[model samples]
Target: MEIVKNRFLKGVTVVLSALLVISLMGCGQKTDAKTTEAKTVSENVKRMPDEMTKVNLGLPSNKNMSYLPFYVALKKGNFQKHNLNVNLSVVQGGVLALRGLQSGDFQIISSLPESVITGASEGANVKLIGTLDIQSMYSIYVAKDIHDPKELKGKVAASMVPGNGTDIQLQYWLKKHGLEPNKDIRIINAGDNAERLQTLQQGQSAVTILSPPTDLKADELGYKRFLMRDELKTYNHNMIAASGDQIKNKPEVIYAFMAAEAEAVTFIKDKANRDEVIKIVMEQMEMKNADAEKSLDFVLPALADHGKINIEGIKWAIDMVKEAGVLKKEINLDKLLDERFYAK
Candidate 1:
């Protein structure tokens, strides 16, 4: 009985020792994986220059994923590579951002070319240097109860702000669907997609236009997809504009800034950077990996190339603005766009 007991005890000790070794190995692997990920993130972040040129870039909304390339550039050191120190801020309204640009509060801003067109018409002396999003990700989403587009009649909707990109987008889509905006349904200037989503959830608005992460969330909530915007391919969305004064005084700065943006967009478009860019989308937009991946495939093909504005797309925006009552008379597109910077 003593011999049998000794053998059993020895077997039990060997099994426990083996289990301990396996556990330690697994923990080491997990540590290594985490360290590698951290290293990657650290490597991707660009360090600020000690004596960098200062440029403030304003954004329409902080949460909109349509402007991901700009964030990517900030993360990927494209700005630093181009010898520019871009300080990005939320200017709230596209027109306000443009106003800030003109007043010297902001050096550059990302907005729909229509806003820039309207500003040019209103005598703000701003010019679009580059187009960021050619095929807009903006799509109309309605509440679950309101299934049909016409059902949106007499219902309320939300936008980024009055006469901004999202508002114009909502109006344009409404007109396309045979419903007169403000005549058929009431559209109010709420806020960004994030804020708009909150208002929608609270039943303040039954319909709104949203971008990627917000759009993905709206889908999960079973909101009715009123207008996918896949048909409106001719019109471009976001553009980088500098005040006429900035364009005249510091054309080189505009060129460097635009070049960095172009590099960032190119980097995001590359298949080799797919994993990293998708990771960026997930982190920056606070989305799951699945949603990020889904958005990547949905939005990748729609990005503008070399940060150059499409002449045809600009024309489309001008036409839309004219119809929206933002522009009373025809303005020459040739004079509005500073194509020299983008051409380089």
Candidate 2:
């Protein structure tokens, strides 16, 4: 409470200082360039006491490389503009992330809709309110010695925990090649993105799915790109979601957070902001100039159209998950969405 009060006070001081600076500038007294830049930044942050919503945003992934919008919202001060104070926490997998949400530890999770779908079908009552990136950014990487998906047959491969999106993707890809996942190839339980990449690099797994930056790096190091994510023609990838009752009690928080995210999305898609967004990505993902450019090229178009959920993609993903045995009984996506928070 004291911290909030102090921040609110600081915000007020910042605003007042800006007005004074403007007054001085109008009087033909030159303002310091550095001070002007500082004040300009301060005005973009919200400081209202009632609206300083604290959020425990869950990121099951280890890094923000995959969730670029959230990273932009944080780095570019979009969250603060909406008075959202975010505390981001990372766990190993979506299962642990959903567990956190169920136990009241997470206000919202940035994950795959498949994760929320799996959780909701099991009586969890979580729903994806909005999608961030609408398509699966994941591309398949194979060992240097392998050329095609078929070549991976009877080879050691890596998979995410069973019933997750990656698992489903692996199954779908193999079935397309007339191969059963478990019988035709050995899928090891690689822990996370880093683990899977290491498994592939160490020759432990012949094939694995990786999203951008990592996938870009894999390509740089001579791994074969078996397939691209967009080739699937179907995806319901990264999304933002919260529990039903939790959202009901504090709808404003969710709304403000979504608004900030949408703002970031706009910033990401604008051509004028291209250089700035790419610079941020380079710093955040620790990518070189070329890889960062490649990443922005790959993901920007695939970002949700103004952060709206793709009902078609969501439905397709649900059907695929059901076929994979992740969901016992099918449930309508309408029952799994609280559409009030995101831009509809």
For model 1, residues 1-344, the per-residue Cα lDDT tens digits are: 99999999999999999999999999999999999999998565433333468899988777667788888999999888877888988966788888888889888998887778888887787888887777877777887788678888888888766666667778888887778878888878787778888778889998888887778888988877753457676766778899889887777688778788888888998899999998898888888899989888877877888887778878877877777777876689777988777623
TM-score attained by model 1 = 0.80
| Pairs that clash in candidate 2 | none
What are the TM-scores, per candidate, against the unseen true structure? Answer: 0.80, 0.82
Shift of residue 156 alpha carbon in model 1, Å:
2.3
Best by lDDT: 1
- Over 1-344, each residue of candidate 2 has an lDDT whose tens digit, in order, gives 99999999999999999999899887654457667888997555432326677889888785555588888999989889878898889887788788888888998888877778888877896878788876777878888888667777789778888888887887777787777878999888897777889999898999888877677778878887755464676576778888776676776677787888888888898999999988998888888888889989988878875578878888878887898887986688677887766643
- Model 1, poorest ten-residue lDDT window? 42-51
Error of 1 at 278 (Å): 1.9
Cα RMSD for candidate 2?
A: 17.9
Overlapping backbone residue pairs in candidate 2 total 0
